[model samples]
Target chain A: MFHIYCPYCEEHREEEEFHPKGQAHIARPEEPEACSDEEWGDYLFFRDNPRGIHHELWVHAVGCRKFFNITRHTVSYAILETYKMGELPRFTAEFPEGSLSEKVTTEAEAMSRQEGVKA
Target chain B: MSNLVAQNIRTFETHPGVEISAESPLVFFHQRSGAPAPCTESRVALRERALLGHLILRGGAIVLDEAVHSVLGFGLPAYPNALSRDEGGERSIQWLSPDEWLLIVPGGEEFGLEGKLREALGDAHYAIVNVSGGQTLLELEGEAARELLMKSTPYDVHPDNFPVGKGVTTVFAKANLILRRPTETRWELVLRRSFADYLYRWILDAGEAYAIGVEV
Candidate 1:
């Protein structure tokens, strides 16, 4: 049983409270009618199955019921970091050192979590 | 923003008139499975505070806070997983998420309160849902209440981790409910109407060793 940290709830909750929603950062085409058959098909059916650092969407279904992102290592099955939606992750495929970074969140960064929401 | 959006939404009383009898979700279960009366030797006590007004408030915290404070006389819980209560302790606002809070008030006050809140919030983008009929609040009080919870849930319920005013929605047995510590010796369980019977039985079974008693 893994203790997954929910970004919105700001606490580590039991993994049973969450549901993993496949891949993260899948953007829908702005003009689906203008897309080619292959482009539309790729958008609808294609997904990356990376072996290393992977970012996925997950929802704290039982707790907060909010969707967030999780950066995890497929091989190690170690969660790198959990961040709110619309926030750029510090751990990515290019740079995956988030687990070692200080957990300190500055006031500015903390305040920025609601950048997309109506304040 | 006053009076702008009130007409856009239709609100009504949830309490079916006084003529029609309203039975709690557990009425049938309690009848079928009689509860053990509390005795001096009982170490755990379970009581249901049924049919209370439950509202799910969603919006920007600041906007909701001002309106809630004005209407309910208490602001929303400042931090996630925290529970804030009014002076009487009968009314509480629990922080469910960054943008959402759960307001539980005494029964029959929800309809009027919702209207007042809607009027106060005016045109602000927000949502207030009446969930009183959808859930029931069960309170556990006694020395072995913690032990009973420990046996049921994996969440840490130790005093150091779950002090008074801390509430969390987590897995308990095979179901999930909002578990909160309102006082030093009491813990509250907000169970969905559908899960109440199952969880009630589970709690009784898990608390059997403690000789849990039901306070009607």
Candidate 2:
């Protein structure tokens, strides 16, 4: 089982102790009042697909009851970092810099994995 | 007080465990005299206290790290899921979500610490909240402490998993807190203020077979 890092517990607990919250590092649009419908739709629906390090949000639902960000790799299912909900995750070139790219990669991989499972 | 319903809970009259009493704030419970006590105040033989001081430190790790190191004489842990502490282990700082941590100091030092952290952090966007009154502490000792914790919490309390100096904020029954094993024979349960009663009842009922008794 993957050892998941709980930001609230401040410890890497057995994966059973946590629940994945989804793609992490989401930022609300600046000046939403000035955005077009297409912009809003893209903001709501778009995501990135990557093969390596990704950022995602998770909640320690059974632990601290707090939301936090995590830097994880989809292939190895390895987590690089866990931070609070509102904070920006420190990023490196090896890892996609923000939520948008990470989300795109995550969705693409998830779909491919689902298809593989089906096949 | 008049209209509140009395909670019915099962309590043990005898148990093979250490009895820790409140001698003072920040005092350690001796293993020699550690035993659970029989209390009538709330039908809780072993009252799980919401103890000590709880402060949430929020800010950039680099900036907050400097502040914590300078002000508290300890550093904010760099790794996720890690706990940083003072020499005595009396005070501990645990990573509580990125850009945030939970610092447990002596019972009365929260306000001062918060002010100091703010000063040390300067204009960094950070937040520190004092939650001492909102929680109580319960010290569970004796051989049965670990087993009892397994019953109360889903997280593994095994020494292999939760070695001494390690602390976590995990689910306990229906609530949560900063759970730590500061001493070899002791387990500290930092509980919230409002849920103290419910947790007490749960512990007494679960610890019944162990003959758990409260000291103070």
Which candidate achieves the best lDDT against the true structure? 1
Query: Best candidate, TM-score-wise?
Result: 1
The digit string of per-residue lDDT tens for model 2 on B110-203 reads: 6666666666766667777676656667877777778888887877888898787666777787776668777777777777656666676677
Give the 10-residue window scoring lowest on summed lDDT in candidate 1 chain B: B1-10
Deviating ranges (above 4 Å) for candidate 1: A98-119, B1-6
TM-scores for chain A over all candidates? 0.81, 0.67
Please provide TM-scores, in order, for all candidate models, with all chains considered together.
0.92, 0.60
Candidate lDDT (C-alpha), each = 0.89, 0.66
In model 1, the clashing pairs are none
How well does candidate 1 score on lDDT at residue B210? 83
TM-score (chain B) of candidate 1: 0.98
